[model samples]
Target: MSIAETASPSLAEADRFRATLRNHPAGVVVITASVEGRPVGLTATSFTSVSLAPPLVSFYIAESSTTWPALRRAGEFGVQLLTEEQSDLADRFSRRGEDRFAAPTAWSRGPSQVPLLDGASAHLVCSRFDTRLIGDHWLVVGEVTRTLVLDDPRPPLVYHRGAFGGVSALR
Candidate 1:
C-alpha cells in the first residue's frame, strides 16, 4: 500500500476514489461472444487501444460478472464501439441473467461466426491476445483480425460522472 493508503482508510476514501474515476470520461464499448452455441454480451467503458503495429485492443471485465465465465470459453469475440444513440443497448448488455439479444437487437454472424452487433460505429473481430487477473477484474487484450467502420454520423457514446453523453466539438 502507498504511505497515504496505510495512514488512513475508510469507505469515504473509497467513495472519493470512485468519484475521482467517474470524473474521467471513458468511451463505451460492448463485447459479444457465442458461448455454448448461444450469444453472450456485456457493456463496458474500459476499452482502449493497446497497440497499433499489431492491432491490439483491451478492456476490463469485473471478476464477479456472471457472464465472464461463459464469455471466456469462446475463443473469439466482437467489440462494438457504441454511438451516443445506442445507450439502450449499453444498458441492456450491462444487465445480468437476461436475453440481451432478444428481439430487435440487430446482429449477424461475422465471417468467423462471432456475433457482431449492427449499427455500432465500429466492429472488431478479436481473438484472445492475453488475459490476466488484476484487482477484482480481468484485463483482456485482443488482437484484431478484422474490423468494420459503419457510415453512421452520430457522436460516440461517452461515460462520465455516472451519466452518458455525446461529444460536441469545440472550436
Candidate 2:
C-alpha cells in the first residue's frame, strides 16, 4: 500500500465524520454496570436492538473510556432509555471523574446489583453476550434477561446535531 493509503487519518477528516453522524439522530441510553458492587455508567447514543429470538442488544463505547475498563469486568449490564427531560443526567454521565449518581440523579440497585436509574422510558437487564473492537470503539452485544416499561408516556431522548431532542409526530 502507498504511504498515503496507510497514513493516519487527519483531525479534520475525523471531525467531518463526526459532524456527518451528528446529522443522523440516534436514541440515547445510559449503560450501567457494576464493578465490585459499585455502579458505573456512561451516556451513549449508539445503543440499538440487534435481535429478537436471542434477545440481543448492542451499543458502542470508546476504547479509551475509563468506565469501559470496569464495565468489562461486569458479567451483565443495565440499559436504561433516557427521556428528553433527562438531558442533564446524560450530560453528567458523559463527563469524567465526577459523581454521576449524585444530585438529582435517582436510582436504585437491581436484584442483580446493577443500578437502575429512575424515570427511564424503559429498562432492560442484559447479560454480557460478546464484544468486538471496531475502529476506535468496542461494539458490545448484550442478551436481554429482563425488561421494564413505565406507565408514563414520555418522549425518549434523542441526540442529533450535537444536541439533545425529543420526537414529534409528523402526522
Candidate 3:
C-alpha cells in the first residue's frame, strides 16, 4: 500500500506532521500580558519581524487560548527571546491551567506597560496593532514601541522535534 493508504488514523497524520516539523528549528519566546493587574505568559515559537521602518512584529497565537482574550483587551504585550538557560521557563509557560507568573522571574516595565522579561536575549515591547483570523490561529501584528537588547552575545534557546536545542554559532 502507498504511505497515504497505510496511514490508518488522524492521529497518525498528526504524528507524521510533527515528525516532519522536527527538522525545522525555531527560536523560543515568551509572550506575556497583564490581565486585570495579573500577569500571564505563554511560550511561543511562531514569531517574526514584519517591518523596520515602522518597527512592526508579528506572532501567532492559538484562537482557543484563554490568555489571548485578555491580551487582546490589554492592547499591549511583551516578547521575551529565551536564552539557553530558560528551558524550564519555557516548559512552565507551555503548560495550561497554571499560574504562569507565580514563580519568581525577573521582569521590568517597558514603554507599553508590559513586563519585559530579564535575561532574555532580546525584548520587544509592543502595542497591538491588528489581528487577522487565520484558520485555527490568530495572526497578531504589533508595532514595536520599544526595543532592547539584553544580551547581544548570548545565544537564544531553540526548539526542535518537541525538545530543546541550543542555538547555532554565528557564522
- Candidate of highest lDDT: 2
Query: Against the true structure, what is each candidate's TM-score?
Result: 0.92, 0.92, 0.87
lDDT of 3 by residue, 7-118 (tens): 6776788888889988899999999877677787889999999999889999999999977888777788889999998898898888888776765666776665687777
State the lDDT of candidate 2 residue by residue for 69-153, as single tens digits.
9998999999999998999999999999899998778999885988999999998999999999999999999999989889974
After superposing candidate 3, which stretches have Cα over 4 Å from the reference?
1-11, 151-153
Where is the poorest 10-residue window by lDDT in model 1?
3-12
Superior candidate under TM-score, 1 versus 3: 1
Cα error of candidate 3 at position 20, Å: 1.1
Residue 10, model 1: Cα distance from true site in angstroms: 3.1
Question: Which model scores highest in TM-score?
Answer: 2
The best-first sequence of candidates by TM-score reads 2, 1, 3
Which segments of candidate 1 are over 4 A away from where they belong? 1-8
Ranking by lDDT: 2, 1, 3
Model 2 TM-score on a 0 to 1 scale: 0.92
- Each prediction's whole-model lDDT (CA): 0.89, 0.91, 0.85
